[model samples]
Every structure is written in structure tokens, then in C-alpha cells.
Target chain A: MTGDAQTPALPLHLRAAILLRLLAIQGVWNYETMLGNGIAFAMEPALRRLPGGRQGEAYRTAMARHSGYFNAHPYLAAVAVGALIRAELDGVPAAQIDRFRTAAPGPLGSVGDRLIWAGWLPLCSSLALLAYGLGAGPLAVVLLFLLTYNFVHLGLRIWGLHAGWTQGLRVAQALANPLLRQGPAHVARATALVAGVALPVAAHALIGPGRVLLGSVLAAVAAGATLVTLLHGRFEGWRLATLALATFVLYTMVR
Target chain B: MGGDILFYVPLAVLGAVLGLDVVSFPQAMISRPIVASTLAGGLIGQPVRGLTMGVLLEFFALESLPFGASRYPEWGSAAVVGGSLFAAIPDGSAGAMSVAAFAALVTASIGSSSMVFLRRWNAIWARGQQRRIARGSGSAVVALQLAGLSADLIRGGVLTLVALVVFSPLNRAIVGTFSMSPVISRAVVVAVASAVGLAAIWKVVRTTAGARWWLAAGVGAGFIIAGTL
Candidate 1:
């Protein structure tokens, strides 16, 4: 809120640099604290560029601060990075910045996990898979997956940077904006629409019609319905594995 | 059996690069099963086989979320094995492709286990750098981070090399010996994969607004179109 309205804010090149580093958030995965070093790597450039409060001290302090047990869904980690940078520039205390770090991963992590990992990614990949099953070329299929996923991927990073820079801590609210809230549900719906149409078509493509085709269709529905329960019920993955074993048994008997 | 060093060396390089991209480096997501498998297939002059493998592998890949400290298979290297094995088979039979896919799945499992070791090594490396990192060692922080990155790169390359060395022959042997009705086998794979895709849809829609209505309309429209034509 204190910056010059006319100063054009953080330079385009710097934002680009920060985002580039963020792309490797899991580069240094560790069993004890996954991405611990990767967080320092991503934050180093921003800490250097923050432009206030004793640059060297800020650099060391920020690096030490972010290196402590930091983890989040990679795509939304930008929001945390942006907010931390904005806080440092605004002259917020080191202790408070640590508070911001603590505050960050919960909202951003959950939203990110739900939206990116569960929602947008599956939708795009499924769409690409459907296209592939329908006999699309590999490059075209890869292009589809990249274009769709990265549009949101890049857009969210850009939004997080600008919003965090401008709004500081308050940008956490923006993380829950309808785009994250409703956008995922909509993508999921669209995926269903695509899957609904593609399922039958792909069946015909992979298996010629007959009693076998009818059985495949029925099994597809049954497996889909069963998995809906497994996914929704919060059952462990092993349960699904067991169900899959059962499915294999049934598949053999039915055939 | 080893007649094509020319065929495999470049594929190994491709595997290394994509495997690194899975969790390190640019992460342009060329590492995802769909793209990586396709690229591996294209490299061996079998884009269709690659595309076919990519689509199948993608079903399992899509099931994973890969969020926050969670461990999951590194599909990038595994898909390379899959694309290459399927393309290697001269006839491109469905039954043969299924066996190749099984081998690739096993490779993916091994590759991910290797990745866990790399993660543990990263932790040790980072802890050693913590003192300098806290005391304003900018170079130290950068060095430690890069070390982690380099380790991941090496880990990926090694995993790819091992999977290829171990599985390539097994894929050939299994495909050569396995004999079954192509229709039944293809039906099983296609049905299971389609069911996985559908389950993903069902998970999303059931949670979203008016999910039931949307599901009804979608199925109704799809069937109507199918029945009419």
C-alpha cells in the first residue's frame, strides 16, 4: 500500500526470474523435510532483490527463514514466495515473516493440492488421454496437455506475484478467489462431459462390439462406481489395491 | 538381441532428461507420462506405439496427486521403458503390448524407490550446509541447492540406465512367450483403463455442484447421440 503508484512495481525480468526458480521447487527433495533446500533456492533471488532492510542481512535472514521445513504444492508455492517478498519490502519483522511462512502452506497447500493436483491436472491429462484413445497424434496430444495445464499454471503464478507484491499478507484471501474455488469444480464437470462421450467411443475403438463389449461397458461402470466410493470414503490406497485385485478376479471369471 | 546400440543410446539420453524433469530442472512437464512416453516412442521411430503407451500409462499417472512430501512413482522413466518396449516388438500385437506395459510398471516402481534414496541423500547434504546458510553464506546456500539438483539429475539417469538394462530383455521374453486372445486381453486393459478415467470423473463431479444433474445430462446426451447414429 506504501509503494509509489507510478513506480511500475517489481520489474518484469525479476518476476520472470523468480518464477523460473520456482519451477524447481522439488529439485532438492529430502525425506526428513522434502523441498527444504529447494525452498531456499527459490527464495534466494527474491531475498536479494527485495530492495530494503539491510540487503545482506535480509538475504541471510530470508534464506535461513525459508529453509526451515518449508513444503507446499509446487504450483501454488509462488503465492507464499510473493507474500514473503512483499513483507520484507514492507519492513515486516523477521519473526512476522516466519509467521507468514507458517500461515502460507495450510491455505495455499490445501487449495493447491485440491485444485492443481486433484482437479486441473487430472482434467487436462484425461482430455489428452481421450484424444490419444481417439487416435490423435502424439505431438498434438502432448501439446494439448501442456497448453491446457500451463495456461492455469502460469496464470496462477503471475497472479500470485502481482497480488502478493501489492497486497502483502492480505493476498492470502486472494488465494481462495473463485477461480480456485469454482474453477476446479467446473474443470471436473467438463472432464466428466468429455469422459462420458469418450468412454463409449474409446470402448468401440479398443474392443470390437459383442458380448465382450457389453461386459466391458458394465465393468467400466461398476469399477467407476466402486472407485467413487473409495476416493470419497477416505479409504487408504491399499483398499483400492485390494478392490483392484478383486476386479481382476472378476474380470477373469466374466471373460 | 543387442543389435541396436544406435536405437538405445539416444533413448537412454532422452530417458535421463525426462526423468530429471520429473522432479528437477525445468519441469516443463515434458516429464508427464503422456508426453514422455510419446517422445520416447517417437525417438525409436514408433510414434503411434509411443502414443498408445502414453495414453495407457496416463491412466495410472492421473490417479496420483503428488502433493507435499508425498511419495509416488516417477512415471517419466517408466513410460520411456514402456514406449520403447512396445515399439521394439515387430508385430505390435495387443497382447505383447500388455506384457511390455507390465514390465514398464515394474520399472516405474523401482525408479521411484531409487528416488527415495536420492531424497535421503539430499537431506544429508542440506543439513551440512545449514550452518553456512544461516551465517550469510549466499554461495553456500546456492551450492547446496545445486548439489541437490545435480544429485536428482544423476539419480534419474542411473534409474533409467538400470531399468533399461534389467527390463528390456524381460519385456522381449515375456512378449515372446505370452499367448492369449488379443480381443480379451485388449478388452481387459481398455476396460480397466477406461474405468479408471471414469472413476476420476465421478470423484470430481460428485463433489461439484449439481454433479448429479450434470452426470445425467452428459450420459443422456452421449447415449442419445450414439443411439441416433
Candidate 2:
């Protein structure tokens, strides 16, 4: 706790380096170490300032320690990088640091998966699909997705770094922020509504007035099939659809 | 299929970058099907057609979470392959979307395996450097990271090249000799895609408390808009 005051702000260049390296933090992911290697790689720039410099014992120990098993959502992993760097610099006890690393990934992974992957991503995607349904140009739709999605993506990375560094071992506090806690549900609701709106609009646009009745019938059948598969819970509708496509293609080629 | 083979090189390159975006870097959903496919289509001066392929593929892609260490489809490179193949066909080809979707799904499965291979390869390489990494050698960590990235890039490129080379002609062959009526073939494809898409939306809607009503309302609104249109 006293380490918060003791931990000096990471220099601008070091912070920048950490940010850049965080981009590739999942590059070396493996079952053994998960994201351990990437965490060390991202944290190295900061660990350089440890008492002995890059070749110093402190730097080496911190690097090796961080290079052990770890995992987190790739985007939110920046928080771990920042917090770990601070903990190392603050000279938090070695045993405590390991515990922190172990405890951290759960919240980071769950929150990030819920907020970004499950909520924000689907929301943006359906919105883009909605735009396409409403006859938005291709470029416009793609741009809308990239621009809107990345706005929060970049902000999360930057905010995560700042929060992690400043809060050090207490960085879990950052995850508790209302935006992180409640964002997924709110986004999910919006996504459902948007997706519902988008599907029919897109269907109408694609099928045109002449085939409206046919399109509706097909949609109804497809929906029924999907619901049956969903009830089964083990199988995915897309996989079934893919199998059907392959079967159709093969049947046509052979016949 | 008749376009210069050289065209595939750049498309493969684009695939590598977008594929890298999948989990390696800047996961800016530019790797999403809509973006990846559109880019591939734009490369061939058929952005709209690419967009069409992208939307269909996006339905399938929604099932992917890209969550921790899960073996999910690599939509980025796959979408590029699908978009490019679909765009390459002359307009009004009944089987174009179907063939492209098939190709993309196949490519995605390949991408998933390649990712698993890359992780295994990385594990071996990382194990080899375990000593140095433990010694806190910055260079060792950097080497592992860079090597892993480079390998992923190559994997994506090769996946794209193989998909394009193999599926391009196959797509043309199937579309050229298609037996199904255009309306029926397309209707089936779109209906299936819609089903998968609706299922994806429903997966989320059902899990979230009280979201179904909003979805129902949205559906009603959608019908109104469709009626007006």
C-alpha cells in the first residue's frame, strides 16, 4: 500500500513502449504460459528501470517472475502490464506479487469478455448490419463499425494503462467502475433491439417486394430450425448451416 | 478465376495483416467479416459485392468469441477469401454467395488449426528459451514475441493464398454448373444465414434478463419499416 506513494510515475518513453508492446501481448500465447511471455515482453520496458537496469538482478528477477503463467483478455491485459510494472517497482513482496498475478486475470478476463467481446462487439456489428439493411453504402457501413468500435477499444487500452499504473496492486478497483460493471447489460439490450430491427430491414432490402412472402416463409423455417438446435445446446446453428452448405455443394457436384 | 495470379499476393498480404489483427495486435475488429470482406472486395473494385459476402459471413462469425485460448474460427483471413471469391464472379451468379460462404467456412477451419499449431510451435520455442526468459533476458522475451508474430503472419498469408488458389476455380466451377434456380439457391443461403444470425442474437438476448421484449419491439418496428419501404 505504501508502494503507491513510493512508485514513481513511469517515464513517458517507457509508458509509450509498454503501450506499443501491449498491442502484441498475445503473440506468444501458449497452454503452458498462456500470456506469461507476452506480459514479460510488454513489461520489460518498464522493468528496465529496476534498481540494476536491464542487466541488473532486480530487472532479471522481475522479468523472469512475470514470464511465468498468466492470462487475461488481450485488450484489458494492459492493466496487468501497468499494475505488474508498478508492483515490481514498488518492491511488493515476491510472494504477494505472484498472488496478485494469479488473482488478477479472473476479473480482467471476465469483465473484458463480457464488456468488449460479448457486449460492445455484437452491438457495433448489429448496428453496422442495420445500416447495411437500411441501404447504407458499403464503405459507410464498414467505416461506421471500425470508427465506433475502435473509439472505445483505444480508450480502454489508454484508460487501463493509466488506471493500473496509478493504482498498482489495488488495480482491481479500476474494474469496479460502473462503466465496466454495468456496460455489458446495457449494451446487450441495445444489441438485441438493434439486431431485431436489422434482420427484418435487411431481409426486406435483400428479398425485395416481389419475394416478400417467400422470404418470410424461409425466415420462419430457418428460425424454427435454429430454435430447435439452440434447445439442443450442444450444437451451433452455423455449424449445421455450414454442413448443409457443404452437403448441397457436394450433392450438386456429384449429381 | 481468370484474373492474374499475381493479384492473390496482395490479397494474401492483406489477409496477413487483418489476420494478425485477430488476436496478435490492434484487435480493432477491422478483422471482423464486414471489414475484412469489404476490403477484399474493394481490392477487386467490387466493394458492394464483397459487402454482401461479408454480411452473410458475419452471421456465422457472431458465434465466435475469440475468448481465452478457445479454438474459434479466424474470421479475418476467411472473410477476405470469401469476399474476394464472391466479388470475382460476374454479377448475378446464383451460386456465388454460397460458394464463397463455403470457401470461407473451410478457410476458417484451416485458420483455427493453424492457430493451434502456432501455439504449439510457440510453446516449443518458448520452452527452449525458458532459461534465458527466467534469467530475465529482455532479448529472449522480445525474440519469442517477434517470432510468434512473424509466424502468425506467415500462417495467415499461406492460408489466404491456398484458399484463393483452391476455392477460386472451385467457386467458378460450382457457380458455372449450378443446378439450382437462382432464387431458390440464394433464398436458401440467405435463409440459413438469417437463421444463424437470429440464433446468435437470441443467444445474447436470452441470456440477458428482460432483453427479449426489446428485441420483440425492435422486430415490430422493423416490420413497420419494411412495410413502409
Candidate 3:
């Protein structure tokens, strides 16, 4: 990649240090500005070495500026770090850099929260629990979970850095990319699929044969009804109603 | 049997590290109850017990979407308390697991409230250092960051210690006092957990078109697979 010659670029060693520091970017989180101070602290190394020939004045200015209000999901903060440094080196005015900061965190946060918190963690945790329940050893379940999760977790940090540096502020558009969107959706679907299949078998294993047969028919019917209703876009109250019905049935049968 | 310092010290340290990891360090899902509790149980020579407790706690923990400024229960240290208590209970009865789980859930709720105080303390410290930080002193920023990390570390460690000292005994007593039949209690746990997991699935898939077909196919295939087995 060609480095822009308008200003001195961040050195490779310095970039490594910044990425390492980014891992602890919430160390100084406050209720007022969240990771604001931590972001400033993480950027301190890169800021100190900005090559401005200004006797460390550049470092002071950079620190004070980044210490303002900032909040974003930690994993997605890499994108901001990469772009922020690139823009600083490109001599993008402080006002413009500030504008980029304000614009980036919100959208990137939603994408990260949805992809990671809502989508990835639940699915991976489910798979791990399912594996554990199926007699997979504890170590195997933990390792499977860690590997499946980090594939995306580490991948995003590494990828975000490159994307933020090269794409600059336009990196927000990367969230809209179809390839990126499809991965989470696919995983979500796979999770639901495996879970749907696995739960009945698990119930059967846990319960007895006669109970399995009766429960399977009832569960299948209830699931089918619920699925149809959800697919038609009316899913809000159905979960509670279904649970209440299931409980009533179970209590009656047990009595 | 009470946890000796050998067990207690490392578990507290583990709680510190994992608890710090919740907000300050890697934020790897290891801070999760399933992983954290399992690790805690293994440290005390009860890996299976810890793992079982973790799986149960993970169900209730799933409802939490820890994003933005949301004040969600802290699970890492709390899970250690739960797992350790369950493992320490004399009998592995359904009542035992339920009591341990309840203790952990209460610890998590307390942990959530404590986080607000921690945040306020961090803010107070940050406010004290604002001028120096703005004055471009690298040491000031470094000091503040280190202070915050140290505070969170202590917060997690102390929380783990207190919950263990207090709730471990409470959990043991509750298990002794309660008298639900094992079969019924276990069945109820399984049923409620399955319902929660199902609801979580619905939240994930209700929006995705054609999800029902894939789910139906899964159910039919599952039944057939079971028959062969």
C-alpha cells in the first residue's frame, strides 16, 4: 500500500504498540465519557511519535483532544483508532478529525453490538453448552467456543485497523457490505437450525420414551404454530403464551 | 468444607482477572458465567460441578445484552461464587443446584449495583486529574489509567471474596432446609431453561425470512436421527 506523502506516516513498531494498547482502552472508563480517557491513553504512543518536529507539543495537543467524550464497543474501537491516526498524519484539521469521531462511533457501535453481542456470543455459547450436554469434554467445549469466537473477534480487530487506515472515514460503508452482513445472518440461521434439532433430542434423552413421544407431538405442533406466527411478523406475545401453555400442559400431565 | 486460602487466593485472583476482563481487558466472553464458573470449579478440583453450574447460569445471563451504558449484572466474579458454592455443597441434589444458582444470581445483581459506584469513583478520580491531563502530562494520563485498572481489579477481587464468605454458607443452609423432590425440581429446571433458550432462539430468528422452513426441516431430521440412534 502506498503511504500518503502529505505527512509522516505512523511507523510499523508504533502501530503495533497502539494495537496492543487498544486492548486495554477501557482501563480509564468513566461514567461521564466512558472510554474517552482510555482512548487518549492508547493513542499516547502514536501521538508522541507523530514526527511533527515540535518538541512534544504535538503529543500534548493530541492527548488533550482525544480525551474528550468518546464511547464505542471495544472491539470496534480499532476502526476508530486506525482512521484517527491516518487522518492525524494526513494533517486533516482537528475540526475534521473531531467530526469523524462524532460520526463513526454510533453506527459502528450498533453493527458491533448486533454482530458480536446479539449474534455471535449467544450462538457460540449455545453450541458449547450443547456440546457439553452431549458428553463432549469440558476442555473441548471451551476450546471450540474460544476458537469459533476468536476467528471473528481477532479477525475484526486486525481487519478493522487496515480498513480504517486505508478507507479513512468511509469505513462506515464497510458495515453495509453484503458480504459482512451475510456472515452474521448465516450464523444466526445455523444456530437456530442446530438448536431446533438438538433440543428435542436432548429432551428425549433427558425424559423417558413415553414422555418423548407425547412431548414431541405437542412441541412440534406448538413450534409449528409459533414459527408460522413469527414468520408472519407477529412474534411479540407468542413466546410467553407458548410457555404458559407448555407449563399448564406439563402440570396437568404430571398431576 | 470451607475453601482454604490456597483455593481462596487463586480463585480471588482469577475473579480479579476475569472481572477486570469484563470491562477493562480483553472482554473475551471468558468473563461469561459458563467459562468463568467452570474455571473456578476446576481450580477447586470440581470441574464438572462448575461446568454444570455454568451451563445453568448461562441461561439467565443470556437475557442480558451488555452494550453501551447499560447496567447489566456482573457475571464473572458472581459465577465463581455460584460454582464454588454448588461444588462445596455436601450433596449434589436439585435443591443444592437451585440454591447455589440463586446465590449467584443475587451476587450478580449486587455486582451490577457496585459497578455504578465504581464508575462514580472513576469519574471522581478523572475529575481530580483533568487539569493535569489537559496540561499534556503523559504521566498524569498513565497514572489515571493505572488507577482505574487497579480499582477495577480490587472491586472484582473483593466482590468475589465477600460473596464467597457470605453466600457460600447461605447456599449450604438453603440446600439443607429445602425439601423439593429431586426429580420434580430437576424437571422444572430443565423445562424453564429450555423455554428461555427457545425464547432466545425466537428473538434471533423471528426477523429472518424462511427461518421456519429451516427450523421445520431441523425438527423432522432430528426425529429421524433419533430413531436411528
Instruction: Compare the candidates by lDDT and give the number of the best one.
Output: 2
List model 2 lDDT by residue over B1-229, tens digit each. Answer: 5556787998999999998889887688888999999999999899998998898888788777788988888989999999999999987777777889999988998999899989999999999999998788889999999999999999899999988989888888889888876666666677777777777777766788888888888878887887777
Best DockQ goes to which candidate? Answer: 2
TM-score, candidate 1, is 0.87
Off by over 4 Å in 3: A1-12, A52-55, A198-255, B3-7, B212-229
lDDT of 1 by residue, B58-113 (tens): 76565555666666778778888878877777753535556656656666777778
Candidate 2 per-residue C-alpha lDDT over A1-255 given as tens digits, one digit per residue, 9 for 90 to 100: 523555566778888888889888988888889999999999988888889798799998998899999989888998988888888887889988888998999999999998888888988888898898889989899999999999999889888888889888798888999999988889889988998888777766655422545646455646755674556467766667778789877776677
By TM-score, the best candidate is 2
Cα DockQ of the candidate 3 complex: 0.34
For model 1, the stretches where C-alpha displacement exceeds 4 angstroms are A1-8, A49-55, A208-255, B1-7, B92-94, B212-229
Q: TM-score of the candidate numbered 2?
A: 0.95
What's the lDDT for all of these models?
0.69, 0.84, 0.70
Error of 3 at B29 (Å): 1.1
- Rank all candidate structures by their TM-score, best first, as comma-separated numbers: 2, 1, 3
Flag the better candidate by TM-score, 1 or 2.
2
- Comparing 2 and 3 on lDDT, the stronger one: 2
* TM-scores, one per candidate: 0.87, 0.95, 0.84
